[model samples]
Target: MPVAIRLADWDTDRDAIRSIREAVFVQEQQVPVDLEWDDQEETSQHFLAYRETTPVATGRLTQGGKIGRMAVQKSSRGCGIGARLLQAICERAKEQNFQQVHLHAQQHAEGFYLQAGFEVEGDVFYEAGIPHIKMVRSLI
Candidate 1:
């Protein structure tokens, strides 16, 4: 199914964004609740992907040009929802004049970011008890 992706307003879309992140990160991945949320919500540009009317995926681009908090519902994986979301986020970054965008991807998902034109930048590190690697994609 084709998913609809759009830039989300944090105040209006907070519930849907929180639901998807809590489901994928806190529940499934066992990431601590404290680590899953941050003050960035108010400042970052958020992206949400929906299947019809149901929210299926989410991601965000921060004011500092960092991409993070990406999550796709378990039932919606491999459906290209993530790629579309990333594209939308990247386009937004370019529109905002960001030189490059970077993300700390979960190790297993490194290949996903790689396929989206991101290159691994450093050694593995732990975040929220999960191994992750830094990846960057130039918007120039």
Candidate 2:
């Protein structure tokens, strides 16, 4: 079965979204405490997914069409939830008048992002202790 998803509203979702991120990027991935949490989250349209009331994934999108902080719970990996969450975010971007989308994908996820139609645009760089590359796709 496809994973269940829930759209996040910052005012109502900050807790769930933060829990998901803290689990994947901080607790599991060991990303530094300071870097994994950021100020931009307040302004971004964050999406948090729950599987039967358990937070399983989360991501954020900016009004300018950039996607970031996508995380799938370690236990939920291989469920295709990440792709679905991304698709939903892209649709949301279009509904909001965005013409393109951008994300800094972890080096390991470049292929996953590629499968989702994103093309790597620049050299790899380090972010949150992981190697990453910028990826972009047009909404059209």
Q: lDDT of each model, Cα atoms only?
A: 0.94, 0.87
The residue pairs that clash in candidate 1, if any, are: none
Off by over 4 Å in 2: none
Instruction: Report the lDDT tens digits of candidate 1 across residue range 15-63.
Output: 9999999999999999999989999999999999999999999999999
Alpha-carbon deviation at 102 in model 2, angstroms: 0.3
Largest lDDT belongs to which candidate? Answer: 1
Per-residue alpha-carbon lDDT of candidate 2 for residues 1-140, written as tens digits (9 for 90 to 100)? 45677677888888888888888888988999899877787788888777776888999997667899999988888988899999999988988888899999989899999999999998999987799999999898
Off by over 4 Å in 1: none
TM-score of predicted model 1?
A: 0.98
How many residue pairs clash in model 1? 0
TM-score of each model, in listed order: 0.98, 0.93
The CA root-mean-square deviation of candidate 2, after full C-alpha superposition on the true structure, stands at: 1.3
